[model samples]
Target: MIRGEVYEYTIGNLRARIVVVSANPYNPQRATFAVILGADVPTPKSPSLVPLAAGDPTRGTIDMTRLRPLTRENLGARIGRLTRTTLVAVDDALRTYLGL
Candidate 1:
């Protein structure tokens, strides 16, 4: 599992942090909603997020860099779809990171 945090800075406010979790170590495509909390801090409600990293590559597949880009206005849905699609493409690029 891959675990991390995300921080967002507002114009006049301190930066906020959210916990990131993934199912696979090598793939961000397999991540799911684990938790959201203060930066560099863990909370009681924090879910055990896991990494969704891919395991291996497949034969006769195109590179991930050649694939089309995905965009979404909804944060939740966009993340869900991105994770699913990323894991599916792990065979082509080994793993994909959205850097969300």
Candidate 2:
């Protein structure tokens, strides 16, 4: 899978969006990513999140709430990809959030 592609992983009852960002050569099963939750996405216990809607087909505001270092073992199927514009927006938001 390439970066910017959104994947739907089996997360019990929640259908969360997983973007395949940077992959780690050290661990093939894992990658650095952000979780995109729909507009109605539940309030996360953690306040860290970036708002995104530019590429989502549903056209709902998505929350890139957390940056996760996750394993591909749980990823189920390919869903879609975020646009170049959306990816740029996310990167900007992330940089701002991290005070970079």
Q: Please name the candidate that would achieve the greatest TM-score relative to the true structure.
A: 2
The segments of candidate 1 whose C-alpha lies over 4 angstroms from its true place after superposition are: 9-16, 24-26, 37-100
Best by lDDT: 2
For each candidate in turn, the TM-score is 0.22, 0.68
Tell me how far the alpha carbon of residue 46 in candidate 2 is from the true structure, in angstroms, after superposition.
Answer: 13
lDDT of 2 by residue, 1-100 (tens): 6667677765667767777655436336557677766667565443345455655543443455567776677787777777878777667666666777
Residue-level lDDT tens digits of model 1 in 46-70: 1122223342121122222322211
The whole-model lDDT of each prediction reads 0.28, 0.64
Candidate 1 backbone clash number: 11
RMSD of 1: 15.3
- Per-prediction tally of clashes: 11, 0
Candidate 1 — worst ten consecutive residues by lDDT sum? 69-78
